[model samples]
Target: MIEYHSLREASPEQTIAWMEVLAENLRPSDLDEIAATSDMDPLLSLTTSVMLSDMAWVITSNDIPVAVFGCAPAGPAGSGLVWMMGTPLMDERRTAISIARSTVPYLRQMHQRYACLWNHIDARNEKSMKWLRWSGFRLLEAVPDYGREGRLFFIFARYDPDV
Candidate 1:
């Protein structure tokens, strides 16, 4: 079974361990964008989520982390940026799918306050793009020279106009 937990439910050390795993396993195509987005330190990104996210969840299966996702306010009136880190889905397909399924409801709940929640996906990360589309986000635009290292990225979003 997949379980969701608050950051307080797991020690900071445990979360950092997950972040380390995510960092070590990032695909070469994703590495530069992730570093640019997260300020070059994956641990800092997770730690920031723990501190600033209005909504966050760590998804685990059989006591092992499958993924962690968080949403934090971004300017532009009730908009937020959504972020996620996970173990390689290819290695844990079932667990990753379970986590992906759970993320939709969590995201819907965030829609209560966030008019739009978006993620910047590396243009070369086709796997992530596929998953994001399946999870209900629209591919809004392709941004050229979007990152610190001049990589391209796509902006994907789920928007609630009523917010």
Candidate 2:
């Protein structure tokens, strides 16, 4: 069974332990993005992201963490930067399907507090881009030199009209 838990329920050590394994199996695009954007190693990057997020959740399958995702305050008021990182276990068809179905509703809930949810996705991450489009996020311009390593990236966003 898959279970979702608030990050608050997870201890720092537990989060780190899960992240250490997840980092090793992170999607290639995620590994590349991290390499381009920060000096931190995969474990550090994943841990830091969790720590900075205002609201986050851990997805566990049968007690083993499979993913961590959440949103952080962006520069403007009512704007947030959304992000997700998961282990290869999430690639299982059943798990992927379930998470995909839940995504839109999760974003809608986030929209209650954030008028705009945005993030930069590595251009090579076609799977993520497709998922974002399916989730109703608009894919804006692509930046040729986006990160410290000067790789390509696309800006993606979803806006709440009611806000």
Candidate 3:
């Protein structure tokens, strides 16, 4: 069974692990926002200085961490930002539905506040775009990255299903 485990007070080891996976997928400028692994003091100082204005979680099963996801904590489901999402390390574990479903409550709660909760998908990440669409988020637009090369991204926003 997959479970949502909060990392509200993540240890240095956990934070570094999360940063390692996320850094691999981020742009150079984005990478500069936090310190490098060799110098993790800034990250830990920044991370624990506040209660993570939002939230971060890891999906684990059988005592091993498989996937990591984070977002702002308030509002309807799906309203917060999804900072990073990585492919699960387990071969048999597939959590697409649950991963997508996790944002439901946030989407509904924050629907009226913003046009919709948005996420950016790398232009080359067709699988992620398809997964978001399958999860019920509609494509809004493709935005060009001003700072990076070949980093065009598709912005997807979550919508109401009951309507």
Candidate 4:
């Protein structure tokens, strides 16, 4: 069964293994985020840091970690960011569709508090860009040399001024 697991329930080793799976899908920009020093540190830091400020959920299938999803403030008082990273699965197409649909309600709730929600996706990750577009985020601009290795990234945003 697929379900959301809290980060608190994961052991250190399990978390590291999940990070390794996530690293396998990263774009060059993601790899450069940690100076290529270690794959585990960046994600570990992200999961831990976000746990305090926002919601963190581990997506699992039959108790196996398949993905991690969460939301956090975007530094600006009324802005926020949402993110997700996942491991490869045999049937990713179905999994992706399920995740996209399941997260909409959560994203909508986040919109009630944060006037703007956004993400910075590596420009080279076409699949992600397309997915974000499908999920209602608009591409704002391309940021050149945005990450450690001078990788380019695209800023995607969804706003609700009424919020």
Top-scoring candidate (TM-score): 2
Tens digits of per-residue lDDT for model 1, 73-149: 98688899887766564336776577667778888888998989997888877777777888888999998888776
After superposition on all CA atoms, what RMSD does each candidate show versus the true structure?
2.5, 1.5, 6.6, 3.8
Residue-wise C-alpha lDDT for candidate 4, range 82-107, written one tens digit per residue: 77656664137887777767767767
Model 2: per-residue Cα lDDT over 1-163, one tens digit each: 7777777788878777778877877877778888887788888888888888887887888887777888988868999999988877777888877778876767887888899999999988877787788888998888888888998888899999797
lDDT by candidate, in order shown? 0.74, 0.83, 0.52, 0.67
Which model is ahead, 2 or 4, in terms of TM-score? 2
Instruction: List residue ranges in candidate 2 displaced over 4 A.
Output: none
Instruction: Compute the lDDT of residue 163 as modeled in candidate 4.
Output: 90
lDDT winner between 1 and 4, please give it: 1
What's each prediction's TM-score? 0.83, 0.92, 0.57, 0.75
Q: Give the residue spans of candidate 4 off by over 4 A.
A: 6-43
Worst 10 residues of 3 by lDDT: 29-38
Question: Which TM-score value belongs to model 3?
Answer: 0.57
Number of colliding residue pairs in model 3: 10
